[model samples]
Target: MSAVMITRKVRKWEKLPGKNTFCCDGRVMMARQKGVFYLTLFLIVGTCSLFFAFECPYLAVHLSPTIPVFAIVLFLFVLAMLLRTSFSDPGVLPRALQEEATFIEMEIEAANGNVPAGQRPPPRIRNVQINNQIVKLKYCYTCKIFRPPRASHCSICDNCVDRFDHHCPWVGNCVGKRNYRYFYLFTLSLSLLTIYIFTFDIVHVVMRSVDNGFLNTLKETPGTVLEVLVCFFTLWSVVGLTGFHTYLLSLNQTTNEDIKGSWSGKNRVQNPYSHKNIIKNCCEVLCGPTYPSVLDRRGLTQEDLPVPVASAAPSSSSSSSSPVPQTTHAVLCLQKTKAPLIPNKRTPDDAKPSIAASAQKSPSPKEENPPAPKAPPLASPEMDVETSINKDKTH
Candidate 1:
């Protein structure tokens, strides 16, 4: 229950309810924290409208034309958006898991120098490219390596993300490797909240317009100015975001995906997530426990891997398979061989060489050996010399 303990625990699939399934797609939740203001505003509108309906017959009669229907519709719309945020394909787990290995590889490359054991060299980023454009890709000076597409660094969290998504201020956390699902739900709920409140305000405005002359309506309605302002803000934001998200979703992409030119026609074949039944594949990603690697090894049960197309067969130049190898055994072998020795833990079978290296650094009797002198230590040069001189004088 403690914060430290909570941090240590990996939330369980079932017990960890409330957007536990989707962690990779940060924007799935949308803008829950930033847009919560509209939810509050809508609640106020609903409350006030109800009050007027009961207290003042004239006001109620005028407001009745639009208030109830508007309130109900708006409420439902907001509710739908909130609910949509929570729903996602649980099937993407396999793909996500597969990509995780590559991410780990990148981390490994960063840690140990590139040089092999006993060599004077270190491993370096082999190839680097920056597109020619005024909009320079944000660089990570700390990591000192060009990030792959969809990757970014969060200033607040101080870690580079694989796919940079918008930051949510409400959670006071970045929707990074761990917390993406919660963020998606947050945005979905907020959009609904905005739509609902906007609807309610619109109805209330219309009803007021009918009750009083158009010019007088402004004076008659309570909080008319506030209502108008909130309504404009909500409609503009919700409409714009919903439209943009629809396009991204249809293309089987996230905000990060869209920005990185992952869908650019020039490299369409190279995009790992591209394939037929993409919607189904993406749904699985959102809902499933295991995710595919970027290499497209289906993380689901073996039965779930997509069958290749026969008629729409890729051109001989294109392979329908993932751009990366399913499992890079070569890299794995190198990693196994290169693992660092941890103190106090039993050395792994692969780390025998590392242990031997340490052993070689210690002093041994053979290494300490020195040439022996022929004479004994007590047989000093001074004694020998004095004896020889006394012998000569005696003679």
Candidate 2:
């Protein structure tokens, strides 16, 4: 049989089997499923446009020339921060290679002392000390590696993310170690921007209302009413999230850990990752060195090197699951089960062997006074069947 076909497909981003969406040759990455992210973009752009066109021009003239300048700065900064949060990598850990996976399996085997074949395996959690505090790392079946500290498998992205905070659909990406700073700053800047737009919209109306009357001001600038409505509804959630993240930042806890009560629970557990000082915690999270993206999305994958996935011993890990088998093996069990068996061809001349065997087994009557019955010598099942067929033919 021919060997399994090895196809080379480009795009390291799409080459990954993880459940993520990649764009711009992996420049832009996001969860496969995004919620309200477009709505967020739409609301920000629409509200800003209305402010610039209707509110900003009037405010720039009467209120202050800096009003439009400051608003533009806020608008541009908010966009830059939002894109940084949404499009950037979220500190995803690459799936373990075969060598790494084998090494880990060996370590597991040494610790577990070999679980007998066909028996239930032990739980895949391992405990290690960090800052003198014990942290249990759970094995990810998908990634085929025990996650590092503060790493968790994101169900949405189907990738293990380091310092996983939460999968924010609003950002269409995971809030993780790499981009959490951007997300936090996005929220912070956005709250200020929202408040700024809201405040100025009212100010514009009041300044106009002094001469034109409040009801007339509302009617004249319809965009002001719309902007106020958008900002008013958006203000609480944006400000609320900013405050919440600020609190979380001070404690140096992730949204994931916070929700799970990792530190705040009645278990009296302390957060080992926390510096204990608020300023230090904030500085560590906000001003810490940024981690480079793990996705080599733009790299070219030469597929044939890794394509001989078929091995004598099949791996149960997800990465090697359903691997195409190789042609050579100690056993052809897979081939035997899957390929149709060839049938043996028989001719009428083939019956001669059975007749000859019967003749050899039956002694001539002339050679003995009485024909003696003799036991047959040991023979294979095929020989026995031939003898039976020969006897039936003679009878």
Highest lDDT: which candidate?
Answer: 2
lDDT of 1 by residue, 173-276 (tens): 34433334434544555565556545555565666677576668666655655655765666576567656755554455567656656557574534444344
- Residue-wise C-alpha lDDT for candidate 2, range 5-104, written one tens digit per residue: 6667576776787888888878888887766889899999999999999988898888789999999999999999999999999999999988999999
User: What global local distance difference test value does model 2 have?
Assistant: 0.87
Model 1 regions lying over 4 Å from their true place: 1-151, 168-172, 176-189, 263-269, 290-395
Give the number of the best model, judged by TM-score: 2
Q: What stretches of model 2 exceed 4 Å from their correct place?
A: 1-9, 114-121, 304-395
What overall lDDT goes with each candidate model? Answer: 0.48, 0.87
Q: What does candidate 1 score on TM?
A: 0.40
Question: What CA RMSD would candidate 1 show?
Answer: 28.2
